[model samples]
Target: MKDLKDLTAIKLKAYTPVKSIRTSWNVPISDFARLTHNPIRAIVEGLKIVPNPDKQLIALSIGDPTTFGNLKPAPEVVEAVRRVIEDGSSNGYGPSNGFLEAREAVAEYVAHQGAVTPNDVILCSGCSCSLDLCISALAGAGQNILVPKPGFSIYRTLAEGFGVECRYYDLMPEQNWEVDLSQLETLIDGNTAALIITNPSNPCGSVFSKSHLKAIINIAEKHFLPIIADEIYEHFVFPGYEFHSVSSLSEKVPVLSCGGLTKRFLVPGWRMGWIIIHDRDNHFRDVRKGLANLSARILGANTMVQGALPDILRNTPTAFYDDLVSTLYRHAEIAYKSIKQIRGLRPIMPGGAMYMMIGIEIERYPEYETDLDFVQALIAEQSVFCLPGQCFEYPNYMRIVLTVPEEMITEACKRLTEFCEKHYKMDDRIILQQQNGLLARMNQY
Candidate 1:
C-alpha cells in the first residue's frame, strides 16, 4: 500500500528505543534489605574480636547443644530419616502446606498445644521460618508486635523485615525473667497486632509456669490480640520446674505456636519446624488462609524431613529426653554454683533450657563501660568468650550456654572468676569478697 521509502520512514519514526543501561551500579536495596539487621549477627560478627593468642579458647557463646559434641540425637531419629530416604515416598513434591501424614504426626505430638489437627499445621524450614511466617502473616507495615526485652534477636529481624514495629516489654530479671504484665499492657495500642512469648526463653532460659502463662494469656485476651508462641524449647525444663505452652493456657485468644525438631531432636541442621494453630474460636479464619498463602512462596518444607516426622515422633523413647534433660540439669547446677562465687558477676539460676544470664556489676569493673567491653576483655585476657547482653538488647549482662562439657564449664567459670578479679575495682572487690566469704560460711552451716 505504500512505497518502500515511505514504509521505511514510517517504521523508523514509530520505533521505540530503550534507555541505555547505566554505566555504574546504583541499584537501590529494598527497605527489607536495608533494615533487616539481625542483632545477634550484627553484634557478634561485627565486632572484630580476637581471642587470647596464648590460651585455649573456651567458648560459651553458642546456643546449639550439638556444638561441643556432648549432645546427639537419638539413634531412632536418625534412622527415621534414613528410612524415608530409602523408601522414596518423599522424593516427589508435597502439598504447599505439608504432607498430610507429617502434619498429622505433628498434631499428635503437640497434642499438649490444645486439640490440633492436620489442617492446622503448616511445616516450615525451621523454627525461624515458622516465626517469620507468623510475624509476616499477623503483623504488617505501621503495626507493632510486643517482644520481650533481652529477648531472642530473631523476632526483631523477622518483624523489621516485614516493616512491622517491635515494641519491647520488660522481663524482670529479679523475678526469674517473668513478663511485667503492667509494662506489657502499656506497650499495646490500636496499632499493636500481636504478642510474642518465648517460653524457656533462649537468652534467659526461664520457663513460664502454668499460672504465669495464664497471666500472660489474660493480657492477650483482654487486649483482643493474638499471640505468637515461640515454643522451640518446649519441655526442655529442668526438674522441679515445669514448662507450659502459651497456647495451652489460652481459651479466648488465638495462638500460632512455632516449634520444631531443630532444638528438641538436636538436629538444628535438619531445618524442620512447624506451626500449630490453636484458634478454638476461629479468630484466625483469615490468618489461617494468610499462612497458607505465605507457605506457597516456599512450596513447603523438605519432603524427606516431612516423611520422617511420623516415625521420629512416635518411635523416640521417653528415656532419651529424660537423659538429655538430666545432663543439662547437672550442667546448669555446675555453672550456677561456680559463677556464684565470682565477685562482680551475679548469675541467674536457670530453670530450663541450656543457657544462663549473668548480670555484671559494670560499675565494679571500672575499666569496662559496657557488657561488650567487659566481654571483649574477658576473651582477650582469659580466652573465655561469653555473649554480651547487647546481643539480646540488654546491657551490662552476658549469656552463656550450659550445653558445654562439664569440665569445660568448670574451667570456663574458673577463668571467668580470675578475669573479673583482675579488673574489679579495688574497694568493691574487697567488699564483694567479704560478702562472698560470709555467704560461703552461711552455706557451710
Candidate 2:
C-alpha cells in the first residue's frame, strides 16, 4: 500500500479554479437595478432622513390610480366582493381555472369587442402574472419573443429572466406610437414564440389603431407566431381615441388576450387578471393547454376578486366606466399641458392609460449625458421623481405617470422646467468638467 501511494503521488496536478459558481443571485438586481434605486425610491428614502413635516415630496414614478382619488370600486362591485366574504362562500379554495361565473363574466365582457367564449379565458393573479405564465407556457430558454421598444419594462424583464431573448420592435413616435410593421417583421423568425403588444401602451400611452392591430396580426400570421395582447388598459381610452382589441382583428391568428381589474377598475392591489385564448381557428389548443397547466400549477387567483367578477362585469354601470375615462382624460390633459411648458422635454399626447413619454433634448442640456442622469438630477434638485426612458428601453426619454393629483402636476412640471433651465447653460468647459466628475463619483459607489 505504501509503495502504491508513493507511486500515485509521484506528480500531483495543479488545482484548477472551479468554474465560478455562477449563481443566478445577481439576476434580480441586474435586471431591475434602475427600478431598485429608482429616483422615486431615492427621493422617499432621502425624505426619511429629513425631520420636516411641512415639506413633502411628489411621486410621478408609479402608475397607481389611488393617488388621483380613484379609490373604491363601484358600489355594485363592492357589494359583490362583500357578499362573498360575508357569506364565507369564497373563503375556501376555488377551481384552479377560476369560478365558472367569473369566467363567464370575463367571456361576456370580452365578447363586446368580438367573438370570445368561456373556453378562451383563464383567470390569473394579475396582468404581470398572466404575462409570466403565458410566456412560460409558450417559450423556453434560447427562444425569442418580440417586444415593443419603449414599451412596458416588465415584459422585457420577465422574458429575459426566463432565458428568452427579447427582440425589440420599434414603435414609431412620429406615427403616434404605432408599431413599426417593417421593423417588427424583420425581428420575427422561426424561433420567435410570441409578440407582446400593449394596447394603450404602458409608458408610451398611445393606443393602437385598427389598422395598426391588423398590421400586427398580419405579421404574426406571416411568422406563424401567437400574439400576446395586453389590453389591461383597454377601456381607458380618451374621448377621441378608441382601444381596438387584437381579438377584434383576424380570428385566424391566435391571440392570447391579457387583461385585469387593475387599470379599468382601479384596484391594482386586488391582483385579479385573466388570459383568454381567442383562437377562432382553434390554432392555440396546445398553447391553451400549456396556459391551463401553468395556471393550475400556480393554484388560482384571489377567490374574493374572482367571486366579485360577476357583479363587477354585469352590474357595474356604464356610467362609472365613463366617469373613470373622463377623469383620466382630464388628468392627461393637465399633465400634457404642463409638461409642454418644460423647455427640454416634449410629450406625446397620450390617447389612453395613465402615462406619457417626454423626450429629453439631451443636446439642449449639456450637463446630462443620459436620460437616467437627467432624471436623477431632477429628483435630487426638485424632489420630484419620474421613470427614465431607458427603464422602458427608450433612451433620451422619460415617462411621467399622470395619475398624480392635478394640482401636483403643475408644480412638478414647474420644478422640472426650473431644473432644466438651471442646468441649460453648460457650454463652459468648467461646468462640463464638473458634471463629468460628479457623474463619475456617483457611479463609483
Candidate 3:
C-alpha cells in the first residue's frame, strides 16, 4: 500500500459519476396509491392554460394567506421561534403526541372548546394531518362518513385514501350554505362512522350560528355519530357574525376538533396543529389512544415550533388578528360588490373565511359548457384565475381567494367585469330590464 496521503489522492482520482442503469423490471403499483387522488390538483394541473401576455397573472386560487406577502406574523411569534432555536432544547425528538407544555398551550388557547387539557390535545404536522388522524381513527375500510357538499375537498381526499367512503349532503347556498337537515339525515345509515362539519367553511365561507350548530348536534345526538369538526378558521367570524365550535354545543356527541396556526397566525408552512378531543361522555377514550398511535407515525410536528407554542399562543397581541380580519373583510366586500354588479353572476356574500363563491349562469354564457370552461376562458383572456366549483363537487360556480393585496383585488374585479360583459348574452327580458333601468336613471336626472 502507498503512503496515507498518496492513497487518498489515488482514491479521489479514481472516483467517477455513476450512471443510472436501464432495467427491464416493471413494478406494479398498489391499489391504494392508484386510487388516491387530489381533485383540485388534478383539475387545475390538467387544464391547458395559456394566460394573456398583455396582462399579468393574478392567481386567486390558492388558500394560503401569506401568498401575497401583504400579511405577516407578529414580532412576538418570530421572537418566540428564534428563542426556541437559540435554546437548542427543541432539536431532539419530542413525544409522539407532543410536548406536554405545547399541548397545554393549545388547550389554553382553545378554552372555548370546553375544558380542554394537555391530555385532550394531540399535536400534528398541520390541520390537514390533524384531520387525517381524526378521519383514519374514526372510520375504516367499508365504512362511510357524511361530508357537506360544496365543502373542502380534503375530507374526500383523506377518507377515500383510507378506503372509507365519503357521502355528500347538500348545502343550500341560498340559505347561506346551511346543511339541508332532511337530506343530511337521509344519508346516514348503519355504515356511517362520523359527520364532518367545516364551520366558517372553506369554499362558501359561511359561518353557522349557534342555533344552527345546536341543530346539527341534535342530529348527531339522534344518530349516535361522532363528529369531526374542521374549525381551522375558528374565531375568524366577520364583524356581524359569530363562530360557534361544533364541539362546544354538543352534550352527547364526541367531537375531534381540528385547528392550527396555519391561517390565523399567517404561517402555513410552520406545520403546527392540534386535535381537541371533546367527548362529554368519554366516547373518545379509545380514540384518544388511537390518535396517540397515529401521531407516532410522524413522530410529531416541528420541534422548535412546538417549543415556541406557549409564547405564540399567549403573547401574540389581539390587535394583530383584528387588523388581519379587517383587511380580509374589506377585501371580501370589494369582491362581493364588484361581482354582484356583473351580469350573469350572483355573488354569495361570505360571513367569514378568506374565500367568496360566485354562482355562474351557464345558460347566459352558452359558449361555455361548464364552469371549468368559463374559468379557463377567463384565465386565457383576463389572466385572472379562480378555482372552478368542480373542485368542491359544486358546479355552476367558482371560488376566489380574498387574501391577495387590495390593488390586485380591484384590478381583478375590473378584468372580471370586462370578461363577463363580453361573454354574457343578454336575453330579451334582461335587455328590456336594463332599458327600463336606464329610463329610470334618466328620469331621476
Local accuracy by lDDT, each model: 0.92, 0.80, 0.93
Clashing pairs for model 2 are: none
| Top-lDDT candidate index | 3
Better of 1 and 2 by TM-score: 1
For model 3, the superposed segments whose C-alpha errors exceed 4 Å read: 1-24, 428-445
Candidate 2 least-lDDT 10 residues: 46-55
Model 3: per-residue lDDT, tens digit, 1-445?
5699898987887896665675878777886777688999999998868899999999999999998799999999999999999989899999998999999999999998888889999999999999999999999999999999998999988988779999999999999999999999999999999999999899999999899899989999999999999999987778989988888788889999999999999999999999999987888889888888999999888898999999999999999999999999999999999899999999999999999999999999989999999999999999999999999999999999999999999999999999999999978897999999999999999
Candidate 2's C-alpha runs over 4 A off are: 1-55, 67-70, 426-445
Task: TM-score for candidate 2, please give it.
Answer: 0.83
Models, CA RMSD each = 6.3, 11.2, 8.7
Per-candidate total of colliding backbone pairs: 0, 0, 0
